[model samples]
Target chain A: MIILTAAPHMAVWGKWLGDALGTNAAGAPAGNAVFGIFLSLLVYLIGQWLFKVGKGFFLFQPLFVGMVLGIFILFLMAKVFGTTTAEFYKSAYKPGGDIIFWFLNPATIAFAIPLYRRNDIVKRFWLEITLSLIIGLVVSLFFIYGAARLLGLNDIGIASMLPQAATTAIAMPIAAATGGNAAITAMACILNAVIIYALGGWLVKFFRLNNDPIGAGLGLGTAGHTVGSAKALQLGSIQESMASIAVVIISIVVDIVVPPFAAFMGLK
Target chain B: MASQDKVPQTETTEEKPSPIIVQMAIFAAVLFVSSLISPLFPPSFPVPTPVIGLIILYFLLASHIVKLRNVEKFGDFMISLIAFLFVPSGIQLAASLDILKAQGIQIVSVVLIATIVMLVVVAYTTAGMIWIRKHVFHRSVDVKS
Candidate 1:
C-alpha cells in the first residue's frame, strides 16, 4: 500500500518512530514482528494473485515474488528516508522475519506426524526408500563436484557446491568448515530450493515418473529439502510423508558422509 | 433427558485441552528441547535438531503418549503452512542479490542441472527397487508357495 500510494512521507515517519524507540540499535534487537510478517504475507499474496492471473509464469513463485518485492520496498524506503538497506532491514524486518523463521524448526520436526500417519507405506517400502536415498546422495555428490570441477571451480567451490542438495542446517557448516564461503553455500542452497520448486512438476511430467508417491517423495526430498517437501505436500499426504522421511534421512547421511568425503577431496 | 445430556456435555467440555492443541503443544515442546540440545554438539556438528525433534515426535506418537487422533488436524495444518513459513527466507534472499548476481550463472546452472539429475536418478532407483522387490524376488517365493 505504501509503495502503491508513493507515501514517502509516511515511510519516513515510521523510520523516525523506530529510531525514537531505540529499537533500531545494532544487535539489541527490537522491531515490529507483526509488520514484517504482514509485509511478507502481502507480497506472497500478490505473487499468488499474479500466478493466477498471469497463467503461471515460472518466475513468480511466492518465495521469489515476496523476496523481490520485499527488497524493492526496503530499497525504495532507504532511498526516500535517507538510510542504508542494512539499517532498514535490521530495524524494520529482522525481528519479525527471525521469529517466523524460528517456526521453521518446529515445522520440520512436525514432519514426523505425517510419517507416523503414513507408517504403513513407510514400513512397506523402508528398505527401497533408504537404498534409493543413499544412492541418490552419492550420485548427486559426484555430479555436483564433477560439474563444479568441470566448470573450473576450485576445491572450496566444489566443497560448497557439494552440500547444495542437503538441508540448510546441515549444509552451511560443512561449507564453512571445508573452506567454502558460508554466504555462497547459503545462496546455493536457496537456489537449489527455488530451482526444484519451480521445475519439480515439469521434471516429473517430462520424465514420465508420476504414480509412485514414494518415489516422487524421495526424489523431491533428496533434491529439494524443505521447499521440495512443501511441494510434495501439495501433491498428496503420502508424498508429504515420504518426502519428510527422505529429508530426515538425507540430512543424517549427508552430515555423516560429507565431512569425510570433503577431506578425501582435499577440501580442508 | 435434557438435563442429563447437558451435564455430560459440560463435563466433557471441561476435561482437557483439545487433542489438536495437545498435539501442537507437544510439537512445540519437542522443538524447544531440540533447540536446547543443539548447542551441546561440537561447533562443527550440524545441529541435527530438526531430525531429533522428528524422532521425538515419532516416539510420542508410537508410544501413545501423544495420540495421533489428538494431533492429526494440527499436524495437517502445520504441513499446509510450511511454505508460508519460508516467506522470510525468500525475502532474505533480497539481501544477498549482489552475491547472487556475481556468481549467478554458475550457481544457478549447477543447481538446475544437479537437481534435475538427482531427482531423476532417485525416482528411478526407488521405483526400480520397488519393482524388483515386488515382481522378481517376491514372485519367486509366491511361485514356490
Candidate 2:
C-alpha cells in the first residue's frame, strides 16, 4: 500500500505520461504493437549502451522499462490515432485485454503445463499454494477495506479497491462486477509495478529477509505480475519459475475469489 | 575444412525428421482434435477447449509421444498468440471515455490503494512463513537432531 500512501504524485505523472504518449502517437503510422516492441528493444539497447554492458543487464531486468514502453505505445495509439487500427489493438490482444475470455480457457490449461513440469512441486506444495492464496487474499482485502475507511473513500470505494491488489486481468473483472472502472484497473497495474520497483528493496530490508527466495517470489508475483516475475527471475531461475507459477496461480485465484467476496459484502 | 567435412561422409548419418511443415501440420491437427473434444471434459471441469488442447499437446510432448524439437515451431506460434491478448482490451478505456471521466478518480484511488496493500501484505505474509519455518519449525528439527 506504499503506492497508495504516495499516489497523488504518481497518478499525476501516469496521467501526464499516458497523455503525452497518446499525443505523440496521433501522427504515427506504425501500429502500437510493432512500435511497442521496437521501442522496448530500443530502451533495452539504450540501457545497455548507457551502462556499456553487453548481454548482462538485458538479463538484469525487471521489465519495467519494457512494460512502460508498452503503455507508452498504447497511449500514443489511443491519443494520436484512436480512430484507426488503434482501437482494434486494445480489444484484439487475446488473453488479458479485449478478447479476455480467450485467456480463461487457456490460462487454466496452461496451469496444466506448470503442473506437468512441477509435478513434484505441486505434490509437495499445492496445499501450501492454496492456503497462502486464501490467507493472502483475505488479509489483502481486510487491509484495503481498513485503509479505505481510514482514507474516507467510503464502503463502495473500499469494496472496489479491494480487488486492485490482483493483476489487471483478474482485478478488472472483480472491479467491473463491483462498479469500478476498468481503466483505473489498468492504471493501477502500471502504478503497482512502479511502486514495487521503487519500494521493493526497502520492504525486503524491513522484513529482514534471510534469503528466503520463494517467499520473495510469491510476494512479488501475487502483487506485481510480470514485473515481479521478471524481478524474481533475475534473482535466480528457481525463483523465476516459482514466481511465474505464483503469478498465474494468484491471478486465477483472485479471479475466483475477489468478486465473490465483494458479493458477500453486498457491494453491488 | 573440406577434409573435415569428408570425415563425416564416411561416418554413419543420423536419420532426421522430414520437415518442420510436417511436424507443424501434425501439431495443428492435434490442437484441432483436442479443441473438438474439450467440451467432453464434463461440467465438473472449468477450463475451456483450446487450453485443453495445449494440455494434451504438452503431455504428448513430455512423455515422448512427440519430440520437443519437432513441435517447437507450432508451440511458439500458439504461445505468442496467447501473450499479446491484452492489447485490444486496454483500448476500451478510450471507448468508455464518458464513463471513465465520471468515475476516474474514484476508481484510480481505490485500485491504487488496493494494489499497494496487496503487495505489502502478501510480502509480509510470505516473510512471516519463512520466519516461522526458520524459528519454530527448524528449531524443533534442530532440537530433534
Candidate 3:
C-alpha cells in the first residue's frame, strides 16, 4: 500500500517537472517561456536545413518556413492545452518571442556597416540614386494606394501596404505609426522580399537591365529590401554596394514620405 | 574591375579583424548612444533609433574614428541573423489569421503586381538616369566594370 501511494506521488512530481520544462505528462509542449524560445530556434534551424536540402527553392526560405512551422506548432500546443492560439502565443510564446524580436533594432543598426563600406559608389552616383529612389518612392505609394483601394481593402489595409517598399525593420514601425497593422506590414514586407528574390533575375532580363548593375541594384534594394540586397550581392560587388545604399536611402525617404502621403490619401 | 583595382592596398594589408568581444563592445556603444539620441525627435515623425545609429556609425567609419575592421566581423554576424530575427514577427501573423484568411489571395496578388511594377519602374528610372549622365551630360564616369 505504501509503494502504491508512493507511485502516485512520484507521478505528481513528474507532472510538475514536465510543466516547468514546457512539456506535459504526455510529452507534448506545455505553455512555458523557455520552450517558446527553444521552439523558435529549433524551427528556424529546421528552416535553414530545409532551405539547403530543397536546393535553394524560394518556398524553402528560412524566414517563411520558420514562421509557418512555428505558428503551426503553436496551434498544436494550444489545442493540446485546451486554449486558443492567441492565448498560447501571449502566455507562452510572447515572452521568449519578444526577447528575440528585441535584437531587430541592433541588427538594423548593423546595416550601416555595409552602407559605409560601399560609400564610394554612393558618393559617385548620389544624384542618380536620389532621383531614382524618390521617383520610386512616390510611384510605390500611389501604386499601393491605388491597388489596395481597387481591391476593396479598407484604410487599415492601405496604410499597412504603404510602407511595403521599405525594409521590415523600418516598415513595421511606420505602419504602426500611420495607423496600420504592424503584423500585416511584416507579412507584406516578407511577401515583397520573397517575390523579388524569386523573380529578380527574370525582372532584370525582362527589363533589359543586363548592363545596368546600378539600376538593378537600386531596384532590388528599394523594392525587395534585405533579400533583394542578397540577390544583388550574387550579381556583383558594385550591385551589392549599390543595393545597400538603396536600402538606407529608401528607408529614410519612406520615413519622411509615408506620413504625409498617408494623410493625403485620407488614411489616419 | 575598375572598382576592384581602386580598392586601397592598405585594406588588404590590414591584419585580421578585432576580437569578437571588442567588436561587440563597439556595437553596444554605438547602439547605446543611438538610443539616447533617438528620443529627441518628436513622436509624430519618429525616426527609428537604428537609423540614427546607422548615421552615427557611418560618420564614425567615414572619419576613421572607428576602424572598419573593428566592427566588420560582428556587423556581418548580426546581419546574418537578420532573417532569423524576423521570424518571431512573422509568427505574429498567427494572431491575424482572420484578415489573412479573408483576403489572402487579394493581398498576395496585390503584393505580387505592386512589387513587379515597382521593380520595373525603379530599374528603368535608374537606368535612364545613368544613360542621361553618360550620354547627355557627357560625364566621364567610370563605367562599372
Candidate 4:
C-alpha cells in the first residue's frame, strides 16, 4: 500500500522474486508488511478454497494451490503476450530472483515480549540455556566442519556455509567475508528454520524436559532465529519468552563463534 | 494488607500494556544503545544489550514491577511473526543456487550432520537440566524417625 500508493518504483529494489512476479498483472501492490500480510491472507483464502472445492493435488494447501493457479495464469499470459511477456518480468527476476527481506526485522524485535515474560524461568534454568547454546554452537560447527572436510569441501565452501543457521541479513555478509557461499548461507538459514520448527518442540517434549522462559527462549531463538522461538512459544508462553531472549544471545554468540570456530576447525 | 491490596489494585488498575508495542520499543532501545555503549550490569557475551534487556525485564517481572500477563502479551506477539521474518532467508535461496550447485552434495551433507548433532546435544543438555532441577533443587519433605 505505501510503496504502491506513494512510490511505486521502490518495489524493484525490495526483492527480486516480487520484481519478476510483478511484470505480470499481479505485482505486489506495495512492498511492505501489509502486503506480506495480504499475501499471507490470500494464501489462507486459497488454501480454504482448495480444501473445499479442489480435487486431487490442488485440494491440499490453499496458498500453494493458489500459487499453482497463479503459475497457470503466468503461462496463459505468456502465451497471450508472446515476445512481450519475456520482457515483462525482467526487472522482477533480475539476478536475485526478485525478493528482499523487508518484514523480518519487525518479527525479530517482536520476540522481546516473549523473552520478557519468561525471565525467571531463564534464571532458574540459566545453566540449561547456557549449556544448550554452548553445546549447540560446538556441535553445529564441528559437524559442519568435519563433514565438509571428509567430503573434501574447499576452504571457501566450509567457511561460507558454516554460519547459515544464523539470520540471513547478517549471515550473508559474514559468508561474503569468510569466502563462504552466500547461497549456502541462505539455504542453511531456511533449513535451520525448518529444522527448528519440526524438531524444536518434539525434542523438548521427547526429553520430557523442564524449562523456564529464558532457557527455552534462548535455546530456540539462538539456534533458529525467530522461527526457533516460534516453536518454543508453542511449548508455552514461558518457553516463548526465554526462546526470544535466547535468539538474541545465541545469534550474537554464534555470530562470533561460527567464523572463528569454522576457521579454527577447518584450518582456513 | 499491603501485599494483598497492592497486588489486586495494580492488577485491576490500568489498561493492559500492549506487549508487542512495548517490546518493540525495548528492542529498538537495545539495538540503539548496543550500537553506542552497552553496560554490563549482568554478565553476557557478544551483544550486551539483549542480556541487559533480558535481565531488566526479568527483574521487573520477578519483583512484581510488571505483571506477567502483560509481559505474556508482548511475548506471544513476537512468536506470531517468526515465520514472516524468516521469509528473507527463503528469498536468499535463489542466490545460493549457484553455490549450492557447485558444492551442493558436500555442503548439504555437512549441514545435515551439524543439524542433527545440535538437536541431540541441546536436547540432552536440556533434559539433564530438567533432571537436576527436579531432583537436586527440591528437597523431599518426608521425615521418618
Candidate 5:
C-alpha cells in the first residue's frame, strides 16, 4: 500500500531532520544551542496557536501545552541520540534554555510598570491588601509545615514547600538557600499556578468571590504568581491590578519571612 | 511648585513610547545596579537581584524619574512573555524524574491541599476585610474605572 511505503520514508525524514539539527549518528549530544532556542520558541508558538484553535480551553493553556510538547520532543530526541533525557537536556537544551531563562529576571522587573500604574488603588487599599497577605502568608506557612510534617516529609520537603507561594524566580532561590531542592520548589510553584488557572473560576464561584475583585485578585496572584495574574486579567482590570500587587507584595514578604519561618520550624 | 508645574507639560509633550533602544538601556542600567547591590545583603537571607531591580524600578517610576512612556511598551512586552520565559525552568522537571518517581504522590497531594486552603483563606480574608470597611466604616471603596 502507498501508506505502508510512506511510513518508512517519514521515519527516515525525521532522522535526517534530527541529524541536520545537530543530533549525530554516533548518538552524541546535539551540542547546538540555537536548536534549543528554536525548539522552545517554535513549540511555544505551536502551543499558542493551538490554544487559539481550541477556543481558550483551560487544558490548552499555552504554557501547559508548550511544556508537554516540548518535553515529548526532547524525549524523542534523547531516544534518537541514545541518551537519557537529563543528559540531552544538559548537553543541548540547557545552553539555549539558560538564555531564555535569563530573561525571567528582567521580565520580573517589568512588573514594576503595573505596580506603578495602579499606585492609586494600591495606596487607597494598602492596609487591607497588606493585612490580608500577611494573614494568608502566616496561615499558609503553618499549613505547609503541619501538613508536610504530618505526612512524614523531611526538612528539605518542608523547606521547599515554605516558599511555594512565591513566584519561581523568587521561590527557587529561597528553597535552595533554606536547604531545599530548587527543582522541587519550581515544580510546586508551577503546579500551583496550573491548578489555580484551571480551577480559579470554579473556586471563585464556590467561595462567593464573584463580587470581590480585590479578594479574587489577591488570592490568584498570591497563590498562583504570573499565571494567576493572567487569570485575574480575564476577570477584570481591577482584578488584574490587584493580582499584580499581590504578586509583588507576596514575593517580598516571602523573601523576608520564609527563612526565619523555616529556621523556626527546625528546618536546616 | 515650579517642578510640580512642569510635570504636566512634559507629560503632554512625550505621549509616545521612547525608542526600544532607550528602553533596553534603562533596563540594563537598573539591572546592573541591582546586581551590584544584591550581594550586600547577608547570605542567610538572600534577596534575589530581580526583586531588588523591581523595587528600584518601582521607585523610579513613582518619582517620575523614569516616565511611564519610557518603558511602558517594552515592559508590557516583557510581562506578556513571562509565562514563555518560565518554560525553560519548567522543562527542567525532565531531570528530576527520579525524585518524582519516589515521592510524587505525596508532593502532589501536599501541594494540592495547601494551595486550595491558602487560596480560600486569602480570598475570604481580603473580601471580608473590604466588606467590613465598606459597610461598617461607610468608606467609599468603589472600584475606580
Candidate 6:
C-alpha cells in the first residue's frame, strides 16, 4: 500500500527536483549518467534514513533497499514520463552506475589490508583454510549446476547459476565468458547475498559454527560474499578476518577453475 | 590475532603517511599492471586483475616493502564500503525484468538452498578441522613429548 502511494509521489517529487536543479528528466544523454548516479546515491541515502527510523524495517539491508528504491523510481519515471525502460536504463542509469561498478575491483583489492592484519592467523591455518575453500568452491559449483539442470533451465541459466556464490567482481566476467548473461549473474549474486544476510546468523547458530570463527567465516564468505562478510563482522574480528580471506581465495580459485571445467563438461 | 587484545598494544598515536603521494602511486601502479596482464589469458579463461592486484599488495605488505600504516587507512576506507560499489549492479537487475519474472522464484530458491548448504558444509568442515587439530594432533604431540 505504501509503495503504491509513495512511488508515484516520489516520482513526481523527483521530476520536480530535477527540474528545479535545471536537469530535465527527459534530456540529452550526456548529463543523464551523472544525474543517474546522483539519483541512485540520493535514493540510497533515503533508504538508509528510512531503515534507521523504521528500526531496520523488514530487516532492510541498505544496499538491497537502495536497489529496490532505484528500480521503483526508475520504473515510475518511465511510466509517468513515457520513456521506455530500456532507454532509461541504458542512457540514464548504466553510465553513472558503471562508474561505481568500476570501483568495485579497487574495493575488492583493498581487502588486502584486512588479510594483512590477520596474516599470522591466516598463516597458522593456511593449509586448512585453502583446503576448506577449495572444497566449498567445488561444492558451490556442483550445487548450482546440478540444481539449475534439475529445474530445467537452459545453458545460459546454468552458466549464470554456477558462479552465483562468488562476488560480482569475479562472477560477471566468468558468466559472460561461459555464455551466460552477465546481468543474470549479477542478479544471482545479489540474491545469494540477500539469502546469506537474512539467514546466515541463524544458520551459523543452528550448525554450532559460531564457536569456530574460521569455519563460520568460511561458510559466510563462501556463500554470502559481501553481505555474508557484513554478517561475519558482527560475529567478531576472527569471523570478519576469516571471511575476508575466504572471499578473496574463493574468487581467485573459482576464476581459475570454473571455465576449463565448464568446457570439459560441455556446459554453456 | 583474531582477538583484539592478543595483538601487541600500539599506543593510540596516529601515524601519517610520510608521502601519501608515493603510497597512492604504488597502489595505482599495481592496479594498472594487474589490469594490463589480466587480459593476456584467453577470454574463456580470464583472470580477474583485482585478485592479482590484491596479491601484489599482500606481497608488498608481507615482505615489509610497504608498512601497513602507509596504505592501511586507504585500504580500509575502500573495503568498508565495498558493498556500496555493488549497489549499481544490483539496481541494474531492473534491466532484466522479463528474464527475472520468468525464473526469479526458482533462482531465488536455488540461491537460498545452495547457500544454506554451502554455509553448513563450510562451517562444519572448519569446525571439524579445528577439532582434529586440537584433539588428535595435539594428543599425538603430547604422547611423543
**CA-based DockQ, model 2:** 0.21
Ranking by TM-score: 3, 5, 6, 1, 4, 2
TM-score of chain B of each: 0.72, 0.50, 0.80, 0.55, 0.82, 0.76
> Where is model 3 chain A poorest over a 10-residue stretch in terms of lDDT?
A1-10
Which is the leading candidate under DockQ? Answer: 5
User: Tens digits of per-residue lDDT for model 4 on A1-268?
Assistant: 2223233554454334334345333433333334333434454456556667755232243423433343343334434334222232232232222232443443444444554544555555566567667676777677777778889888887877676655565566567656666656766666665566556667666644434443444556655666676677677765666566566556555656765675566444
Worst 10 residues of 4 chain A by lDDT: A88-97
| Pairs that clash in candidate 5 | none
Q: How does each model score on lDDT?
A: 0.70, 0.53, 0.80, 0.53, 0.81, 0.74
lDDT of 1 by residue, B1-145 (tens): 9999999899887654467667677777888897788768774455567757777888888787877666667777776766667677656655655655666677667777778887888888778776888787783211112
The model with the greatest lDDT is 5
- Which candidate comes out best when scored by TM-score? 3
Better of 1 and 2 by TM-score: 1
Which 10-residue span in candidate 1 chain A carries the lowest summed lDDT? A1-10
TM-score of chain B of 4: 0.55
Candidate 6 lDDT over residue span A1-268, tens digit each:
2222334556566566444433343444555567667877887788778879878654466777778888887777666545556555655677788888888877777777778887887777787788777676676667667787787777877777776666788788887888887887887777777788777878888778887777898889888886788799999877887887787777777787788767866986
For model 3, the docking class works out as: medium
Off by over 4 Å in 2: A1-111, A149-160, A165-167, A209-211, B1-84, B96-113, B127-145
Considering summed lDDT, which 10 consecutive residues are worst modelled in model 2 chain A?
A91-100
For model 6, the stretches where C-alpha displacement exceeds 4 angstroms are: A1-30, B1-15, B18-22, B131-145
Model 2 chain B poorest 10 in a row by lDDT: B136-145
**Candidate 3: stretches off by over 4 Å:** A1-32, B1-16, B143-145
Cα deviation of B76 in candidate 6 (Å)? 1.5
* Candidate 2, position B37, lDDT: 85
In DockQ, how does model 1 score against the reference complex?
0.47
Task: Provide the lDDT at B11 for model 3.
Answer: 69
